[model samples]
Target chain A: MSDLQARGHEDWLDDVAVYALGAMPMQDAQRVRAHIAACEICRREYALLQPAVGALAESAEAFTPGNGPIVASPELKARIMRTVRPERPGAATVPQTDAPVRRSVAPRERPILWPVYLVAAACLAIALISSISDIMLSGQLKQSQAELAQLRSRTNALASALADRQAAISDVLAAGAKHYPVDNGEVVRSGSRLYIAMYDLAAPPRGHVYQAWTLPKGSKTMAPSLTFVPDAHGVAFVSLPAGAPETSAVAVSLEPEGGSKQPTTKPLIVVPLD
Target chain B: MTEDAVVLMERVRKRDADAFEALYDAYHRLAYGLAMRMLGDASTAEDVTQAVFVKVWSSPELFRTGNFGAWIARVTRNRALDVIRSRTVRAETDLPQALPESESVEDTAFARIDRELVRSALASLPDEQRRPIEMGFFEGVTHQEIARRTSTPLGTVKTRIRSGLRKLRAQLEMTVTT
Candidate 1:
């Protein structure tokens, strides 16, 4: 063995393992590539290791759908095609390879079944064209469906946003209307509708209704406004009778269901409406 | 070189769309399959696959005369490994499951058989050898990282990987020769 080969042979073989896996560091890879160029043994070993390293990647094929090949998306093709220029016939000259070109075979004589062959070829051309068209149309349909779904989702979002905005506007406009803040609640008078909004107002116990009452000035009997139960969130909206009562006080009291004509219990809230 | 592949590549160099399309049809699945295996996510695998093809389309000259399948696999693996390395996810033992089989036909008979052989070889590996090798190639984990993560000594990890590779090399070489 040459002195250089004797010294570097073992080390270079070790590097071959890393080289095969493409895991050799860039600096080391340069050294290894150079060594392989000079050493026939290293080159053969490196070449042999390549197929194995490649098989490591090829093994992944089994995990794919059907343990077989996957087709590229039509959109991907379209995108690639955008940047790809079709060869203008004879635009660029191809450099010849080292491999020898095989001689072209002589044309064979036509069989007696020329008509049948022609008919088969025509049928095949039609079938091939039809299949390609079908594939393109299917891809387009899927793209359209996806777009439609996205549009529908966006439309629904817009509708929800619109609803939220309208609700906010209603709240802002209600702020302008006469508002009477009662205990843990507020009475809002907008046009003929009187909205009672309560916060932290627990729902009445069983067999009870939260009754609204209007106590007119200088009146012994309290006039009933509305009756309803607050929701689980401890919030309720009740519309009182149309037309505001001047010189009166609004009140809420827990009463028996089918609300009492007059509040039979202590008022939970009372707000004066001048 | 396979005759069909040589023809397709020549046409691709000439920027022939039909030829390029034919090549894409033939190899996209295997490319995507390798990406999926490395990245462990279908959508990301798809992106990597697209990137690999785009790369090939952009630089058709990179393809050598022979070994089209091997070239595609190498490109796909490298790109997928890049994606995996960029991810914040640490390599773990729980690999992704294979997807449900699709009805698509095999692109070429040779690729199908080659894939089967590789899969068999991989499956035959012991867990110790397989795990480290996968982490190195698929997750782009360094030998040191694999050693640390698996609690194996650095030397042990290296030996296991080298030994595993030797076995694989023998199996693959036999397939090619015979």
Candidate 2:
């Protein structure tokens, strides 16, 4: 066992990697499990790695948009049928049927005014402002401007993220070097209809701020939708611009590390079409 | 097919404004919720859902096989993906670095219970184990990425994660059974 450690056992290590990736061959994995059964150290080791296996099942990066759950009602059916008929579009009506009477209508649906994100952002703005006011206040004018800049950039990224996923405008621009906007639906537009704008930061506000990029032509790879990704709630990263060859996409990450004038760092979240 | 929804749709096809309003009430939230999940954002979800119903009102024939719910889902998914594709953010990487920071603690907690318990558990793991697993899951990183990130040998990273997972599974199993 000490020899295993001394030799830095690649074979043992491979077993663990397999488990973590959830790509280990089953028989080999079983052998590893057997080894663990007989060895307390291995058991503890297995115990340690077990969490990783579990994590593999999680896809725990972020919120994936969900259908929520299934819920239906009799009145719902009755109401639906009332509204629903064999629909024929761009054609004449099938004529009115008998029993247009006793209709119970489900109200015209209004989107919930869940300003959950707005409220949360406000709270965070307050919290981070307190800590970074010096940076904000030192140049007070620039700071307020920076705040606006930051907000604008965030908003731009978020708006782009919310746009439809199949188009290639951003993806084409981002084929190499550039970051795309990310979608965040936290902001809600009111009225019966909601207008979603994909705000383009276009570029960073200042020399120090990050630059925005879009995906390049024929480079549109579908980023995970809400169904799978990290942090599906607050922000969702789509595809980043492919600024680097190692980079499949581009993004708009902040860089005190001052990544490439052209995004050396990962954007907080890749904007859609970036 | 709530009471009001039926009336609204019936009149909607008939192009009755009043009835469409009633129908909108019945399915708006459900539609939004479904769209939000599919689209992953409130605004896009709202847009997709609203567009869907408008399409519903204007042309109810959009729904095939009479499964309005599924139809709505398909439309929204296509629309949402369309929106995603058109926008700047791109790539489908499940990288840990992609998670947004805006989640409230409660949201994190709920996300755990609602999505996958194992993720929440992994989030709670000590930094050592958490880092490696995130590398693997998010980047599809081989032992190499973990080693590179952790600055340890590839073998060390692999050992830590493998053993680490065993412990995690036992913990999860214990908690679930209890």
Candidate 3:
């Protein structure tokens, strides 16, 4: 009988799932790998389950930034090429209309001419100028990406401010307005215009935005208040329905920009508005 | 695409820079997705993804000619996990966990269901089964860690994960067959 058949141990079958999911403790995982390497039956089973286990990670593609996966910095390719092919590093330039670098054997005979030295000098100068331009272009690309990120952050801040203003307005309409400066900002509820002047919170990117949610007593979902953008001074306001529950907690989270029906990321602040 | 990958791998073996670029473009998203889910940080995920490609570029001989996708994926996942292990001390959270809320949306990968199908299958799973599977798969929590955090017996957690995966596999198989 084969080793796997002789062993006839079904217990390790469950471990295959844990192992494939990459959740086994190091020692147990090592043991399982060792077993699979040696046993044909176990290897086949592990192979069959491998694709499904990996599918678990792929399923999470639904949760990525709506803009799609973040592209690695443009310079990353050139940097990788330099590391991989040190002698021919310039070969790593991003797609170009120019001809590919020519690889040729060096001439053994010495050339007797001043023009050769002049040509060599010119080539070196060209290389230096090209290097400088590449660096500057890389710098420009990074700056643009940073600016785009900042714009996305501001957009999210504006969204959260709008949400908070609506929630506060609704709260005021049901009862009377309440104004209080709490910590970083002032909370004002006057008639229908409810405002929350926020302070000291930075903006988030596309996959994340600022969210204000209200948690009422004996309620499960934290009712979404608003999504908004803060001002240059980190101040913002939002107004929502004024008929909000009494003694409720107002929380803020940096969440998916499309706005999670619930908070998917960590909350930055949680305040009880009694 | 698989045939193209094989051709690219052969070209890469011969030090063809253009082929390397093509291969990197083809797989980088999948690699980044896995890394991002594992690390929970985009910058770190980018670093890990770049490093994986760089390793392949530098040492093309280490890879066999066939099955380039599987080889790169296994390498990417292992490297991402190594980074995760090094960065943070794994704290076994003993709190009861809930399924992370995300909608069934469209996305695609080789050897996996389209995004909506995968999400639908996961959503169909019972809470008891789905919770542990999500913790172990998405959060990179160990089986023992999940058991401790959920306050379930270790054996029970393993069974739930295995059963959950089997059901998902069946669901996915139906889609592929159809």
User: Who wins the DockQ comparison?
Assistant: 3
Candidate 3 at residue A49, lDDT? 59
What are the TM-scores, per candidate, against the unseen true structure? 0.48, 0.26, 0.50
Query: What lDDT does candidate 1 reach at residue A269?
Result: 82
Q: Which parts of model 3 are misplaced by more than 4 Å?
A: A1-8, A38-41, A65-71, A81-274, B65-67, B90-113
Docking class for model 1 is: incorrect
Model 2, stretches more than 4 Å misplaced? A1-13, A19-274, B1-120
Interface RMSD of 1: 14.1
RMSD after Cα superposition, model 2: 22.4
Q: Which runs in model 1 stand beyond 4 Å of their true positions?
A: A1-8, A64-74, A85-274, B88-113, B173-178
Name the top lDDT candidate. Answer: 1
Q: Over the full model, what C-alpha lDDT does candidate 1 score relative to the true structure?
A: 0.66
| lDDT string, candidate 3, A35-120, tens digits | 44333445456655556665665566556666564556667667766665577646745666678787798878986677778989
Q: Which candidate order results from sorting by DockQ in descending order?
A: 3, 1, 2
lDDT of 1 by residue, B78-170 (tens): 676666545657444222211101111112323334677877777677889878777776666566667779999866776677777878766
Q: Which candidate is the best by TM-score?
A: 3
**Considering TM-score, where higher is better, how would the candidates rank from best to worst?**
3, 1, 2
The deviation in Å at residue B19 for candidate 1 is 0.5
Clashes, model 2? 130
A192-271 per-residue lDDT for model 1 (tens digits) = 44556664578788999899888766776688867898765455656566356553677889999889987788898877
